[model samples]
Target: MTIPKELEKILEITKEQNTWRRKETLNLIASENVMSPVAESVYMSDYMSRYAEGKPYKRFYQGTKYVDEIETLTMDLMNQVTSSKFCDMRPISGTVANAAVFRVLANPGDKALIAPVQAGAHVSHTRFGTLGALGIEHIELPFDKENINVDVDKSIKMIEEVKPKFVVMGGSLYLFPHPAKELSPHIHAVGAKLVYDAAHVYGLIAGKAWSNPLDDGADFLNVSTHKTFPGPQGGAIFSNNEDYYKPVSRTIFPWFVSNHHLHRLPATAVTALEMREFGEEYASQIVRNAKKLAESLASLGFKVVGEHLGYTKSHQVAVDVRPQGGGAKAAKTLEEANIIVNKNLLPYDGPEAVSNPSGLRIGVQEMTRFGMKEGEMEEIASLFKKVLIDGKEPSQIKREVMEMRKGYLSVKYTFQDGEWEQKFSSKVIPMII
Candidate 1:
């Protein structure tokens, strides 16, 4: 097929420029992941043309019969993946899933306990988030420095004192597994419901890497697909109880969104099914990679957050970068060398702005998925130390990064004997290292 002159020029530019850019950037962002070729293929299908406006059974637009199937399949996959009685795939992002939970569970003035953003809570549940703006009282959870987990005793005291309407657990930078089930009884002592934000650990849980929040007695659970789940960018909500279905569906539909992209649904559903089969392997590898990276980084005299395995029960590893000019300067210095990471705030950070905090949060998910194991992590950490500790030139580091990335040909996951599938396979889940 001959390409038209006009489209050909655009294609040429896209192929020459953006393609290489994607190839070069070493994505260590904890919340991001490269979707399988199969997942990407589904996004570009005819389903993308649909404009369904409601749930699977009913819609405001015609030609939604197929979209209905896609929605149902997505829901079923989410249920299986999370083991929830009610799972809704309508929320466009994890934030929206959380919003839906807040809408259904808390009144305008009701108090909702959450971890402070500096303490590693996501914005969705923080006082800086929608929860605070919508008249929902925000109570920040405390962490135990010795154990690096939520201080359930302190939180229980706060719950009794505040009488919060809902108690939220989990966050973006939480390295340790949340004791939601054990803590739920304490929250209920003050008539509060437990909501677990499993965004970071969804893939880990599916991989049997960490315990599931639902099984741990959380009433509500919210997660994003792009993180450790290794799926298309999307969000999902699952509940231990079926009664939340209607309220959640309502909050997601007319109240929060309309015509939830049918194209994204099929892609997300396919990703979910893939996760159900191969997620355990993928997720376990992520943890193993993180563990290796943390150990390597710590061995280099870097201040790693959790010295123990359970302290970082998932993929994230946070390092205090203040000794090396804080997170902002460190991030810029590293980025100039073609290495990417984000500045973050630690629990004990004494008043650093969110944009320019004192720590660097790193992850091994992308590298792990790309087939880089312990040795590679050690190499990356050595590079990191050389650049930061040895004071190597930023440009010199970029050249090294370019060479390092070249060794890994592509980001796509491969199957048996190079017969690579375009999407994730639930059965291909990797074992924990």
Candidate 2:
């Protein structure tokens, strides 16, 4: 019994990445998270090999009874967590979720207002992405630079003037809550629907650490399950509005998605149940850690954004890294030191700055799941300063970073037993192999 050399190499690389990302490095990428061992185990089930297209109990394929039950359970858990009357656990990714909603709500030539790219709108909401593919006219909502949110008065005026088919709220670089409450009434008055893409903060809302956009008058809530939600890599749409349920669900299957990745259902269900139990504490600590990280970075002369608004209410913190050779260079340099982050466009960064944006987006949710706290956030900021400000060698910083990560290797706030390695070895890895 011998493994092929090429296959061996692939396994080696995956093992390396698993060890590097899971054990050694500090992940600050705002869009990333680690699933709990229980969820991870479920993610590797035989369901991965199956397909259950269309909705539960009505599938295009047979032999889907259990799959249907799992999906139904998952949707039920999603409804419970989101407090929405209807939930669809289908769209394979966040962008796909956006596409389904767009397909149902707007015609090809209809106008849709979205948060500006500089203000954190995901590409799916812009002309360069899905909206463009659908021939929908995408317009930017006015952004208030000093406040780091939508220009409510101007946006309301724009909504009246343009009268778009729908207005999209929420974005990837979200800091504070959007003015959904303020603008929803205005959006509806103009005969437009309000949609919130809560991909980054879905878990926060579920945990009650942030406001639910549905509660703030949004007609639909879309999310990617992987980010702060700590589920499988998939997407979901939730809403209380009965009118949207049938159309949106049908659009999701025959139009935007097929098969729907049945494996994600049980994993998502487990994560949803876990969130119901530990999400409040996990989400609260994530925000607290983010605020502390922002303050520490600002104190270290990093020009952290949104200081006047108490840094952040979510899991993210943004820093202007132009002073230390710009975000592109700074992010790469941090990676060399085993600290992961992504370059992002600040509101002031023009379209030309997309390739070399002046800002870095950092999220503390994964680390918070690893049981790191406010004090640890300060230490992480020091690591950033050493690498970016002091111009210390990244190799030197990497050693210290690895040492610092030694104690906080276990994933917390879930129903897993013992240290992460022990739990993975005894429970997840054995089951998978």
Candidate 3:
């Protein structure tokens, strides 16, 4: 049988991306990660073709006997990793999780305080994103330029003055730990809830490198599975405040999510278990690699942000690429060289500068999972220098990029060759043909 032209094109494009991205290029995208082989194996199960509209063991649909068990197990693993009493994995993305929590805590006309953009507030926390859509007024807390973070004292004052229903913390372009411990009390003092979006640093928290927001007095902690955590793409919300559970869980169902994407449960469970065993080692190396990459880039004369504060404590490095023709140009150049990074807004830039922002945000998590360390970070820095600084032709530099990517193809810090295939997936997942 002959394939249609459009279908053949789609298949060819898929093959090209698999070769080019998975096998050849260096991926530095901060908000992304790859799952391990075992996790991927389980993720391709029959769950994709099914639905379980409600909580495990309490489904709205039939044929959900196995769904209840897997979803329950997945929730248990999530609770263990995050050290929270209540967790819901119904939201399909971090933004949706944020939306459900935001709606549950604050009414449509209510006011909410958030860390300012420069201090690393994710878009979901801003008036331009979810909050705006919900009709809640989003206010930015004070930022301390000297510390490169939220101004705790000033923000406390703002919390009192604004009387916001909730306070939002965390970021898409994060570096150091936020003042969650310091701000959570003040937020509560004003009868406000503290919501921490730990999407970018869930693995670090599980590994015990970063403080868990719930322990720091945050009422709720929200996360996505595929950032530094290296799971399938999915979201979850965790909280120690049991009072908020029923309402928030209901909001997640009827308000924000429906079927809940059943396939994510198994894959997420595998990743959670991986973090339980190897999170500390994996998270620690991520920070080390990030710092090394920052130091290396700075040595090559790139203006790495937070230099005086030791670059970064997480798996991220922010660079001011203005001198190298700003972030958009620099990122495009590096992509041409098979090196990936994203254009990002810096503290000094206004919202108008988003299209041609002044900085580049880089994450070391994926490469860290691929087993690259300090020495490899230095090598990567040289590749950046060759493409962005020394003015080398990108096609020539891509050859070197592909060479470096060769040895690091195997994923680390996981049950890479586990028995999930023989024990479960073989029985559960059909061949799909």
Better of 1 and 3 by TM-score: 3
lDDT of 3 by residue, 99-121 (tens): 99999899889999988999888
**Model 3: how large is the Cα RMSD against the reference?**
1.6
The positional error of residue 51 in candidate 3, measured at the CA in angstroms, is: 1.3
lDDT of 3 at 429: 45
Q: Candidate 2: list runs displaced more than 4 Å.
A: 418-433
The residue-by-residue lDDT of candidate 2 on 171-214, one tens digit each, is: 99999888999999999999999999999999999999998999
TM-score of each: 0.90, 0.96, 0.97
Candidate 3, superposed: residue stretches over 4 Å from native = 417-433
> Tens digit of lDDT per residue, candidate 1, span 1-433?
8878989898899887654445665668788777665676567767656688877778888887878887887888888877777888878789888888888788888888886554467888976787976779887777776776678788778878988888888888878887787688888788778888988878888778898888887888888888888777778888877775567767788877786666677677767777777777888778888888888988998988867643366788898888999889998898888778888887677554667787898877877777788889899899899888889998998888888887764553423224444343433433232
lDDT scores in order? 0.78, 0.91, 0.91
Report the poorest 10 consecutive residues by lDDT, candidate 1: 424-433
Better of 1 and 2 by TM-score: 2
RMSD to the true structure for each prediction, in A, is 5.1, 2.2, 1.6
